[model samples]
Every structure is written in C-alpha cells, then in structure tokens.
Target: GKVIEGTLSVHAKGFGFVLVKKGTDIFIPLEHMLNAMDGDYVSVEIVKKVPKKNPEGRIVKILTLQNKEIIGVFKSSKEGGSVIPSDERYNNPIIIPKDSLSSPKIGRKPKNGEFVVIMRTGWNENDHTVTGKIIDILGKPESKEMDLLLVARNNDLTIPFPTQVNKALTGLPEFDLQKELKSREDFRSVPCFTIDPESAKDFDDAISLVQLDNGRFELGVHIADVSHYVREGSAIDKEAYERGTSVYFVNNVIPMLPERLSNDLCSLKPNTDRLAFSVIMEIDSRGIVQKYRIRETVIRSAVRFTYEEVEAIIKGKKHSHAKTIHLMQMLSLILRRSREEMGSIDFDISEAAISLDEQGVPYSIRPRERIESNRLVEEFMLVANRIVASHIAKKSTKRNPKPFVYRVHEKPDKESIQSFLDLLERLGLKYQLDKEVKSDDYRKILDIIENLDYKYFIEKVALRSMTKAYYSTKNEGHFGLAFDAYTHFTSPIRRYPDLVVHRLLKYYASKEKDKKGAMKGEAATLSKKLDSICTHCSEREIRATQAEREFIKIKSMEFLSSKVGETYGGIISGMASFGMFVELSHYVIEGLVHVSELKDDHYDFDKEEFTLTGRKTGKVYRMGDSVTIKIKSVSKEEKRADFLLV
Candidate 1:
C-alpha cells in the first residue's frame, strides 16, 4: 500500500487525478477509484504505469474519504435503475440494484425525466461501477427553481441549514433589544443612508458624508455588526464558517447566515437602530486620508436609495435628495483619483439577470450595471479595508505581531499571461507585460484594450489572464486591487470574513481590562484557520458559480426548446472536435453547433487558435467571434441543446 497525498483534480470525462506531492499526478482510473470523487483525498497504488507519458494508479489503500456528496441527474435502465451522473469529471455512473429501491420497484420509476440525488452506498471493483440508492426525487429539472436546487445539490451546497443549526439559533442573546447603546457613538442624527439594488435584502453598508469647516470632508463607511449577534463558537458562527459567503444565484440566494440575521437583525435597514462597525475618515479635497477612526457605533439610516436614484443624481438630473448631489460629485472625484493613483484596471463586463413571468418562464435578461452609488460605496469600503489592513500590518511585527486574515491575490500564471499577451499581439494591440509587470501595470493593458477596435475581444482575453483573489493568513497583497494590505470588513451581514474582522476590531476596541488578551489569542486562532477556510470558501464559491452558470444554461435551453429552427446572432463560446458552443447574443443562451451541421463545408478544428475552420471555403468560427445560429434540437431530459450555424 502506497500513501499518496494531494488534491483531487477532476477531468471533463468524469475520471480524476490525485495530484500527489509536487507535480506528480497519478491517474485514478474510472474503475479503481472507488469511494473517491472530485476533491477527495485517497491513497493509491502504482498499478503498472510508466512515468514518461502518464502515471496511472489503483486504489489499494483507503486512508480517508471526503464526506462531500454530489447531486446529479438520475436515470433508470432496462436491467434495473442507475444514475447517469451529470458531472463531466465523474465519468462513471452509480448503479442502483433492483433491491436497493426505497419503495417503487427498481425498474419502475418517474416517467424517465426526473432528477434525483444518489447516495453512494459502496463500489464494486469487479464490475467497475458505483453503487448508490435513490435518496430524493427532484422533480422536473425544467421547473422554476429546480435548476437552482439541482445546481446547489450538485455543488455540495446545502440549500437549507440543518435542523440542529436552525434550532440552535433560537433564544439568542437579546443584545439588540437591551438599550445598552448609551456609550456608543450616535450617528442617528446624521443623514446616513443605504443605497443598494431594489431586490437586495442584506444591506451591509451605509454612507454618510459631510464637509467640515476647514474644507475637509468626513466620510463614514458603516457596516452591519453581525459579530454583535453571532458569538464565537456558536452554531451560527460554525455554519457561517462552513459557508464563507452568501451565494447569489440567478433567481435566489443561498445565504451564509439565516434570514433572520442576514435580512432582518444584522441588515442596515433604514430608520432602525442597527449596531455597526464603522470607519470614519477625514479627507481633504485631493482624496488624501488625513485622519481615520475605527469604532463600534449605533446607526439609524435616514433613508435608503436605489442605484437608479444615484445614477440620476450623477447625470445632473433632479432626483430625490438633490441636496447631497455635491457629495455624489465629490465621491466621483475621489473614485477617479483612486483609480488614477492606484492604477485600477478598468474592466467592464456584462452580467445576465433573468426575469420570469407568472408561468416561471424566462421573459428577459437585462444587463446589470454598477451605478454611481455602487462606486461610492465601493470606494469607501476599499478605503476602510485598506486602512484596517494597514493598521493590523503595522501593529504586527515581522517576527510575531498581531495575527489577522488578509485578502490576497497572487500574480497570474506566467504561461497563461504570455498566451494572453500573444493574443493581444495578434489582435494588433501594443502593450508590454513581462516579468516586472506589477499590479499597476494592468492599467496599461486596460488602456490598450480600451483603445482597441475590438475592445470586447481584448477585454475578454485580458480577463482570462487574471488570477482570482481570496482570503488567506499569509499576505501576498492583492494584485487586482493594487493594495499592499487589504481585508474585507464592510459586509458583515453577508460575508463571514467581514464578521470575523468586526469581531476582532470590537475585541481590540474594548476599554475593559482582561478582554484584550483573550481577543488576541482568538484572533490568532482565526488567522491560522484562514488558509484552510480560504481554500474551502474558494472551492465552494467556484462550485456555486458553476451551479449558477449551469442553471442559467438549463433555463436557456428550456427557452430555446420551443424555438427550434429559429435563428439568432451568437458568439462562439467554446469549441471541440465534434462541435462548437455558441451563446446567443440576445438571451445569452448557449447551445452546441455540431460539426456535421455546417452545411457550407467540412470543418477542421484549429487547435492552435481554438477555432473550427472550414477546409473548403476557409470559413472560421472562433471563440468570441460572432455568427448566426439556428436552434436544431433541445432535450430537457438529456440536459442538452443543439444549434446549427446559419
């Protein structure tokens, strides 16, 4: 028995590789890798394979298996029932024996078009199949919220908190009701307000800005003090740790905390006495931070403004609260200066938002925007995060200062960056990015993209070349934010990290004796756990994103199901030897344009550029290139949609 330790990297074909120590990845064949799925840790034996081409292995020893379960589409066969798993990486299906059926006869099932969650019972090595029992029947995947539910289940996301966790939230300390807010700073008199989307419930941040006598401006970044409600080691805290942040899907949101906290108690609702962790900064006309203060305060937001109202103010049109239009102008200037001095990359990407009618059918997809209010709140939050991170970093020494979690974004892979640079060159853009390219250097690339004739193409390429940011114990600095020290401290109502930051800050803010040391030790423990939490949260976030995308895809397919033979403008999203994926421009719906459907001529895949090139006519369909496509076939059962190049 050989012990191999590594992360499980899944392949598109359902099989996966246990990426062992260093770059050594051992292939876990579909048959032998039992009780092991994607993201699982397992020990494997070198079952006869040469090292040169690829190392293959068999699972002869089982050290530990991840308790993570998967949600997928279930199927039944003539020879009994089994699940044809939906995850592309998990190639093999779990076969449910005739006797394993819960109630209905093994062969008799839901009209051949339902979805189910399969519980992995065991695996049969000889037959090379996974054994499972049908645990649930997630009726028609085409339903309104079924796609979201399936995606969540598939991504290992628990849509509802466990019974125990929910019950534990009852009878919480009446800290909010107790009028012990005498000592805290009262900002209720000030005209502080919240600005968020119309549908937003978790209002984490509020803003209050006023000009001082000396011409300097006082700005407040007030965040919901969720730490005041969820104590350390509490069930809610543990659950929040498990779910690092709330996952917002197309139609619903899987909240990090319960609705009582996220939407009611901890939310910065207008005209309500809400506890908040605030960052008050005094700045001159030039956006220079003159003085800053971090304090736990009580706030009652005067009003709530939507992004539309703020946009109206920015456009110089008279809207509600026209008196504070000057503040909006000042914030605009501050954002401009921050972008200029910080070299923030200007990346404008469109997001698809679904609108459904009474029948639950998607009526439209409107592009979402980040209006002036969004930017104003963003700048203030960034300032607060930067200040808090800097304070923590400065207070902590090189050897052992204070332990704190910092959001870090490492440099993108050199190869991937070079590839993107090469694409930019091919697109006839002039921008130099080499080994010395820092965070600020991204601005040059952004500038080139902005100036390019094909701005969208260049922007897409640039985006593909960037690395994602995540929270961590070690500080590598955030490359995207152009910050030396950055932490998320302005969304305690929604993000667990923000709650942690609030707890640490309030602990240090306490004037009472003997409380400071215990807070420091607790903060250290949190700091140490940051890395593990970072990885878990990052993985969960990705899973949630993928699930959302899949749900959208399903909805798109459902929409196209009734429109077969209808043509629409589309962009090539993906390509393979068999077919190319085209996303409709109007609805952002994706479907496969099969190779055989190219009636004009036979096409061959250009591997170098990832395009399908017609051999005879020289027509090419490449990623991001626009073309017209007609829906050919759609099957909600198979979860597939096909299109033909028109």
Candidate 2:
C-alpha cells in the first residue's frame, strides 16, 4: 500500500500507533516516530510485517501537528523560562523565550508555578525540546479555575463565543407570539411541565400527560425550537455545528450556543409561552403507541419541577402535580418493561456528583442518585427519538429518502465478545455466553450478577465489549436501546444533531409533490455531505466527553490531595502489567496500586485472569477484589493518585 495517511496516537512509553481508516493500527517504534507527536496527522510506510503481530511502520511525513497549543505550568529559571506540560506524554519541557515578557499583546507575564498557554512555534532538533511563547496566563496551580481552563484548553474546547456569532444573535428577531403561533399548533392549554436539575439553566424539553376519555393516554414531548432562531449557515449555527454539543464540567458549562439563545430564547421556562417542535403520542396502558403526530407547536409550560421534587411527588410525599406524576410513573414502568422485553440492556452505572464549595473547590464526590423522575424523562425522550426516527425511515424510500442523521451502534466484534466471556470464566461466574451472542445473552449475564459485588466491574466489561455509538447518515440502528431506527430529536439547545433533525423535518414537511421529487437531487448531495458532518460531530462529542471526564478527575484528585496517608476501602477496577487501578468506595476516584507497593511479596501480572499474583505468598489481587489502601501521593499535574496497599 502506497504510504497510508492516518492520525498518530502516541503512548506515554515513547512509541506510537498510526490509526488508519480501514485497517488495524500500524505500530511505530520510537526511532521511526519522525518527531510526530500525539494526535498528529502523518503519512507512514509499513517497514515490518508479521503474520500475527501488528504491522510496524515508519512515519514518512508529518502532514499536520495537532497539539499546536500547550497548557502547562511555567517555571522561570536564571537562564530562561520553560513550561512543564500537564500531559506527561510530552516529556520535554517547552523552552519559553525571555522576550515573551516584553510582548504586551501576549497578556500578563506568567509567574513561576502558574498555569500558562503556550503557542508552539518550533522545535529544537539538537536538544529534542519544543519551543513556544506564552500567550495567556491562567490562574495559580491547584485552583479550580485553573483546572477548568487546563481541561478546556487541552481538549481544544472553544470557551468564548466569537464576536460574529454574538453579532448574529443581535439581529435575530424575538419570538413574535401572534405571528409564530399562526403557523404552529397551539398546545398552550395542555398541562405540560418541565423536569430538570435544580441548577439547570437551559430547559430544552418538557412533558405533558393527558388521560383520554377512551381509556388511553396522550403524552406530549416538547423540545425547544432552537432552529427557529439559529438558521442554517448562520454564524451562530456554524459555531454550534463546530462545537457539536454542549460540554458540562463539574463547576461550569461550556454551552454550544450563546446564552442569548441557549439560556433565554431556547429555554422552556415555566409559565412562559415558547416555540417548540412537539411530538404528541396516544398510547394504551401497555405503552404501545396507537398513534402519534410530530409538528411545530407553541406550548406554555404550566410548572417547572426539579428531579427531587418529581421524585417526592412519585413517592406520595408531595401533593403538587401528584396525579400527573403518578400517570408518568405508570407509563414509564410500562415503557421500561417493554424495552427490557426487546432485549435492551440497562447498565446503571453510578456517576459521581462532585460537590463543590463556595470557592468552586470540590469537597466531596458521591454517586449521583438516580430516581424514577430521571427514568421518566429518559423513557419519554427515548420513545420520542424512536418515533421521530421511524417517521423518517417510513417516509424514506431506498431510492430517494431524505438525508437524516442517525445514532448508530453496530454489533460487537466476535473477538471482543470472546474476551469478555473469558473474563467471566476467570472471575468464576457461572454464566453462559455464546460465541455469537445477542443482546439478551448479555442481559442474562447482567441479571444473574445483579446482586454480586463484581456487578459493576462486569457491567464495565460488557460495555467495553460493545461498539461505541456514533452518528451516521445511514440508519444502522441503536443496539443499546434496541431500536431499529433512532435519531436525536430532543435537546436541540445542547446537541447539534437534534437541530439538524428539526431542520430536516421542517424541510420535508413543507415540500410539495413536484418539489419533493426535485429535492431528490438535493437529498443525494446532502447524503454525501452528511458523512463529513457525522464524523466531525462524533469526534467533537468524544472531545467533549473527555473534557467532562478530565474535569471530574481533576476535582477528584484535588479533593483527595488533602487526605494523603488516610486509608480507604476500594475495589480493583482495572489491571495492567505495572499496576492495578483501585476505585475508592466512597469516592469515584481511581488510583494506581503499583506492584512495588505490594511489600509483602513480589507480584506478577496474569493478563488473562486480570490479576496480580504473589509468587511466594500465593495471594492474588484481582479485579473486583475489595482492599484497603492508604493514599501514597496525588499529582495534580498528572491528574492521578497513587495508593499503597494496607
């Protein structure tokens, strides 16, 4: 193959791999790296090929450098200043020129040990060190604001809305109630209400329940009509598309759209009439949708209830909207059962909710409690998304279907499934998993291990076995939700795909017979363009997810930094050749237990069993094993913690 081009993914161990589009990654030895850093686009030639082993390659050319901006702590020396990168993968410190302080446009001078953003200018081949100039000085190290800035910069998240985007917002006209209502169905009389987090600023969706006289239920799912204000090809829309989705950090939110829209115009505030794209469904007691209609509508939310409030109502502790809450609870249960019957797997992993003090410092990390209120909103949103997707799929013919974005999840690879089964066997779990397993097979294993101590560990493994879900122009269906066709039809304010779906729905709804046929050519053109859009959106979404996780990790480390030497109960979440990862029971943070810390005996790692076995003592530290560990050290720069077994 003529020198294939791919993105280089670097490891902390000096070597890296070039991930090509259509095949296995090509491993590049350290000597053949050709100065290419992580996330760089490079052209590589396969130099060594073995039948079973990974193909080794040499980077022939670096097409583009991905990490042009570096965020790190500044260290001033008598000779000159340098930056120690937060990401340890870049081993060499970036040499900062003394002239950086004289440049007023580069912002305030960075003090020693303070976080700074460096614009990589060049590299010194002789010393193997990168050179850069300090562009912005972030706050002091270990500060919450500095942590947020580092995470944002490292993930390439755009923090500020561009001036042009903000200007575009000014020209956008306010929702003319009388004019807009003329074109949209009026659902103002519907007893609709929004359920969201207590601290949520943007309420993108609302739910309403009405009991029909004929013993059926009408469910109204109203999503804010963001497309009305953010027109396609506008500055705001382009920025939103580039962002792909809103990123929610522990203490801050980087919204995809400006506050002028996301928080005000697009937010479905209670007692305020708002424009929305509504999905109204009529279903029987069994959660089977008898009929449904999707249309542009105007709705007035009667009330706004937090998840806690709704949960309280469900539990009969509150009387406000008790009837509606009961009806929603009933429908949600039916929907859950129906979905479970269809082999939908529910991996209810606990997510950490880091509690922050007034100064934005993390004080505690606890598992976020999930209640019926959360499930109610989720089940309704799932049904709405599925309904919208089915509508598009039904209207679309293979020859001339409207171009649409789908959330696709392909079946897991056979190798991954076998590996998971092997893990189950090693764990001594008596569960049967076939080579060619279906969704139900995994569900059965999960059910059997529901009450086991290793349930979460097994759940993580099962999740790892499946393919990651992504956006696509073609409908491959969603494996996790067990849906034949699915699109993001809700949360347009936060997600770009949902906004695109809304636009497509409007375009198709307005097309006449002749125009519809003429639009076939446009659809074909759109289908081709959607491939790039899907890929970009998927990549951006991953970046957002990583930033979110990094923020949480940073906060967790900060929270544990003050408690070094204290012992805590934990479970081994992962294993490696060097050490095993232990996640504390009370806190969601995970730390490394290096094999050297097993002072009683020398330990050897068993790859297949995922255990650290002591040669002399015959003691094993395996995945899901409970142990007590004393915090040895915490590195905010490395964003990790080290633990010593007690």
> Judged by TM-score, which candidate is best?
2
lDDT score for candidate 2 against the true structure: 0.87
lDDT of each: 0.74, 0.87
- TM-score of structure candidate 1: 0.85
Residue 258 of model 1 has an lDDT of 95
* Stretches of model 2 off by over 4 angstroms after superposition: 1-9, 14-67, 122-130, 433-436, 512-518
- Please, what is the TM-score per model? 0.85, 0.91
Cα lDDT tens digits for candidate 1, 481-593 = 78788988888766777777777676555623344433456556766676676677667667667777777766666666888888898778778999898777777666888
Worst 10 residues of 1 by lDDT: 511-520
Q: Quick one: best lDDT, which candidate? A: 2
Residue 328 displacement in candidate 1 (angstroms) = 2.5
Determine which window of 10 residues in candidate 2 has minimal summed lDDT.
Answer: 512-521
Show model 1 residue runs off by greater than 4 Å. Answer: 1-10, 14-52, 55-83, 88-99, 103-112, 120-131, 140-143, 173-179, 316-320, 451-453, 511-526, 573-579, 599-604, 611-622, 635-640
